[model samples]
Structure formats: structure tokens, C-alpha cells
Target: MENKVVKVIIGILVVSVVFGTLFFWFTPVKDGKKQLDQIKMNNNYLILLIQVINRVLKLAILTTMKDLKIKLNQLKFQIVLN
Candidate 1:
């Protein structure tokens, strides 16, 4: 269930990134200063989005590692009993 949720979130993020890139490229700005400012704002948002994705990935990795550790300990306990 968690894996499915993560995949959905990642899919949505990828789609949004593509849409934002297209919007930014096609947007028309008559004022040079305004365009520069808008581009900078978009860049900041992109950076933030990237950071969020990285954090999610890190969380998934940590969770998997914890689960593996638990299973390894369980196996070791069983081996010792037998």
C-alpha cells in the first residue's frame, strides 16, 4: 500500500514537472524585467519540488532498511533456536 502511494505521488510529480516546463516555455512576457522575475520564481519552485522528491525517496529507503533489519534479526533468532 505504501509502495503504491509512493508510485502515485512520483507519477503526479513527474506530470506536474512536465506541465510546468511547457507552461513556462510557452508563456509570453512583454516586459523583460517581469519575465526574468517570473523565471526566477519558477526556478525556486522547481528546486523545492526536487527537494521534496528527494526527501520522499530517502524515507522509502530508510523504511526498507528497517524492515530488512527486522527480518534479519528474526531469521537469526530462528536459527539459534533450531
Candidate 2:
């Protein structure tokens, strides 16, 4: 009975190892490389979008400042009560 159990256990281990080796050796490698490339492209697109938004905000702030300066120059301050 003990010999039977040992043989069964060894058989199970050998089968498991064979399956594991086949899975690792025969798996497609291109799918992983494609996924990595897609992630990198998405990251580059996001960076470009952020840079555009920053440029637009800078232009708006500068225009607002110019308008404010012009309004300040037009205002008159007098302390005379007559």
C-alpha cells in the first residue's frame, strides 16, 4: 500500500510539471509586448493634452491682467467735496 501511494504522488507531480512547462514555453509573447506599447502611447497622449491645457490657461490669465490694467488707468480718484 505504501508503494502504491508513492507512485501515485510521483505521477501527479510529473503531470503537473509537464503542464506548467508547456504553458510557459508555448504562450504567445507578442500579446504582452502589444499591451505594453498601448500603455506607452496612452501616456504620451495624456502628456500632450496637459501641455495644451496649460498653454490656454496662461493666455487667458495674461489677457485678463491687461484688461485690468487698462481699467485702473481710466479711474479717477478725487478727495474734493464742494
Candidate 3:
């Protein structure tokens, strides 16, 4: 049950990361400064939400990868002991 939950969460994060990457790539930028100014002026909540989601997804991926590495190492140790 716990494993299933983890898998689902990871899947959601992966999807969010992909969508965020595509959105960032497709978003128009004008002179860099104008982009920032436009975001500020337009009160772009969607951009802010995307940024937050991307950041959270990145952190979650890093954490999940680290956990998997640790589990793999533990499995190797157990095999060695056996």
C-alpha cells in the first residue's frame, strides 16, 4: 500500500515536471527585462504556480532518487551477507 502511494506521487511529479518544462520552453521572452516586467505587471499566477510546481518536482525527484540508491545499497549489503 505504501509503495503504491509512493509510485503514484512519483508519477504525478514526473508529469508535472514534463509539463512545466514544456511551458517554460514555449513561453515567450522579450529582452529578458520585458518578460520580468510583464510578469510583474500582469500578475501572472500561472507562471508562479508553474515555477513552484517545478521546484517541488525537482526536490521530490532528488529525494526519491536518493532513497532508491540507499535501498539498492542495502540490498547489495544483504546479498553480500548471505
- Return the number of clashes found in candidate 1: 0
Candidate 2: 10-residue stretch with minimal lDDT: 73-82
Which segments of model 2 are wrong by more than 4 Å?
Answer: 1-30, 76-82
- Model 2 residue 43 CA deviation in Å: 0.8
Error of 3 at 41 (Å): 6.0
TM-scores, in order shown?
0.80, 0.53, 0.49
**How accurate locally is residue 26 in candidate 1, as Cα lDDT from 0 to 100?**
71
Per-residue lDDT of model 2, residues 14-65, tens digit only: 5655675565455555788876766666566556555655665565566667
How well is each residue in 5-64 modelled by candidate 3, as lDDT tens digits? 656766786686678657755678878897777566445645666676677667667777
Show where candidate 1 strays beyond 4 Å. none
On the 0 to 100 scale, the lDDT of residue 75 in model 2 is 58
C-alpha local distance difference test of each model: 0.84, 0.58, 0.70
Candidate 1, residue 24: lDDT: 78
Candidate 1 least-lDDT 10 residues: 1-10
